[model samples]
Target: MKSTLKKLLPFAVVGVISGATTVGVQQYFGHTSNNEDGSYFTTSKNVSFAGMNTSAVGDDFVAAAKTTVPAVVTIKNYQTKTSSRASEQDMFDFFFGDPTGRNQRQRQQQAPDNMPSGLGSGVIISPDGYIISNNHVVAGASKLEVVLSNKKSYIATLVGTDPNTDISLLKIEEKGLPYLNFANSDNLEVGQWVLAVGNPLGLNSTVTAGIISAKGRGIGILGGQGKAANPIESFIQTDAAINPGNSGGALVNVNGDLIGINSAISSTNGYYQGYGFAVPANLARKIVEDIKKFGIVQRGFLGVSSLDLSDDRQVAAYNAEKKTNLKVGSGIYVTSVTDDSGAQNAGIRTGDIITKIDNIAITDFADLSMSVGSKRPGDKVVVTYLRNGKENTSTVTLKDQKGGTSTRSKADLSVTEKIGSDFDPLSERIKTDYGLNSGVVAKNVTEGSEIAKIGIVDGYIVLEINGKPVNSQKDIERILDKYQGNVQVKFVDDYGRIYTKGFKMP
Candidate 1:
């Protein structure tokens, strides 16, 4: 019995030694294999990591790519150029670069019938060939063509466009198309996997994957750029490698749901630099629906010009000047309130700090813009604000730019409404001073209008439309009565620079 006990003790000692050696080796190497949560610990810094090895969790993007790629399509914009408008082409090239990217001067030096085209991308949103794309992508296009993933091409008709949101809706004559369903963008959280499907750089049906880096990002790419009047810019930021042609493409999640549309990129050289911005799916979907129903965006106006409180420098400056202890990142500081507007009627005055809309916190202009911009005129929103260090709430009814609470359909709009601008015949003295053959003065260029999106201002002088001299509003109505598709306008800016621009007829 003593000999058996001695032999068992030796085996126990051997087992203990082996266990100790294994533990010591593991500690020294800092390797942990039992971490089933896709995490690991290494000896390099005794640090733990997660989501570094995505293969462990099975990131099979094949299903997502298959579902998204078919819904994405390539868009081609064709424009006919005339030799007489070479200088005008230069202006267009300066504002919007030639999509073909060949030598503009060389192309301009070609025949008067030169047909230069641009390339972009689009996404089908309905099974009946209803598509959505960036307004800039199809803007000024004489002809738009959509190419499906299977190489089928079809001429597309422009349904409508909202420049404030940079969203455009187009319809092709086809049935049973692959489309993407809109997901609730408000549910999108940062760091979630997403895929960008588009025709980037003319690459057909290109797909790239990344994560949602941010939400409700306002980067001044939209109305903040001073081009779009009342720009709605609550963008969803992602690192999804969006490039030039990716504009108007689909930004979808792994479940193949559309959350946003790739719109702009943050880059120093006009290329992807790991930062991309998209129009949030919610805002975009609203714009498209409005356009489809009303033939225009039924945009609601909050009726106040304010400064973003999130801008530290601006907030500091305001607080110092106003002698108010305003907190940074609290909300927007109202600088001025529009007269006869809903905000003024609701007792919202200058110096009021708007904090929220409809119970949604307004951390910055982006939040406020999204909350209110999504609603149509006559929509009521509960506005929360701070005045004199006291919190207050008001249910405010939104109004249109004309200070009206009623909605207007396309048929209800007149010729001037369709043109989005009122005009007065140019005075003889003004025309003589400018040495113009025929001219008219543009007035009240409506915000978010097709002409406004083309950079036309309220005080610009209109010389021609469709190459015919426009001397009065009646002349414009006459010419546009028979005009179709792209309408060319020759105008002179305040500085007397003659520029010809094109915009699609609404």
Candidate 2:
């Protein structure tokens, strides 16, 4: 009996030592959560919330979920296309296989009926029904429907959209709705606990918790053809299990304040691969505010072609291109300052190393982009740079893409504002010479305007709208006010050039 008792004592001591070591490691990493009786349990090691209490990170996942889930909503985008019957050539090619057997030419004529509905998520930003969402989610959408956590639904209108930041503003008629306020994403630190609230994969009111894996991360996605035209991507990287349909949802801190908006994920198989990206709240808030106050976004451009020094490969390429032996380092390198742009106008020369903006350190191109992208045109920024190893400073006012320091606000203008154009009456003498009774002249061609995209410039006189005569600016408005997707605009320019352009309304 003594021999058996001694053997059991050794086994018990081993068990006790193993348990003690596990608890010590857990406490150090701050994965402790509270139970009902106030005892703590360790579940993870990545989250840490120091300064909140003498205790380790609080496991307040339930509190954040309850605060945010009600404001996150599912958005359904309904789009329709006119079905086109096969042409004789298409029919012949279908019956008898194409010569290349690839159907490349036939693919170009694809006009299908009832494109599949696209789904995403949105975060309500105000009790008066202003919601912030992803531009890609609702862009080109003919109809938008939002469903809340309580199962109540509402029809939403597109207040304004900015593809550059991939942020869109929407409004519903309802008042006193649940909303989440913005937190300073610039203040968010790495390893801080955060929660992602959204309807991912059609799972409504889902909340996932993780740590802020990184900040000022640029994934090299967005900003191209068929995507954001002038993409601003300085993503807050996390591992919060965001999936499809989480694009426009909220990424909140432990205090339930919005730190970011879940934008995209880094994966090879189209699923979470431990890397998810969010648009920082600071930049998103700027975009939402601009869209709300102005009819369009008031983006500020620094106007300098730069090399992202954060990337070693980009550094090597830049060195090779310019034949300079500069070392790869943090912050943005000014390769060339665009002529007459904000940078050049402010005397920012080539070969300058931009170190700070408004006193905030420019750690990388992402930092610079986010800092400048958040400001509007005509806003002044203090730029600190290194020239020949000496630090110098300059005050530069930002410019719009058109090189103009101006702001755009919505007027009680024609509905054609959706098409990004303003229409005015043509002069009677010119109209008589053109043998026209009345005509609406398109003016103020925005950079990305639909009419401008179809090769029509400002001063083009509109003669027809969808085959109906457009005698006045209101005529063009009345014809397009009810049209959802695209309409045909036939016009004549000042150079006596007659052309028909297709304008798509956003």
Best by lDDT: 1
User: RMSD to native for every prediction?
Assistant: 18.7, 17.2
TM-score of 1: 0.76
lDDT of 1 by residue, 306-417 (tens): 9898999888888789887766767988999999999999999998999989888999988988999899999999999999889999989999988999888987676677
What are the clashing pairs of model 1? none
What are the Cα lDDT values of the candidates? 0.75, 0.71
Candidate 2: tens digits of C-alpha lDDT, residues 136-178: 6664455678888898988899887776777888888898899
Error of 1 at 109 (Å): 8.9
Regions more than 4 Å wrong, model 2: 1-59, 83-116, 224-226, 410-506
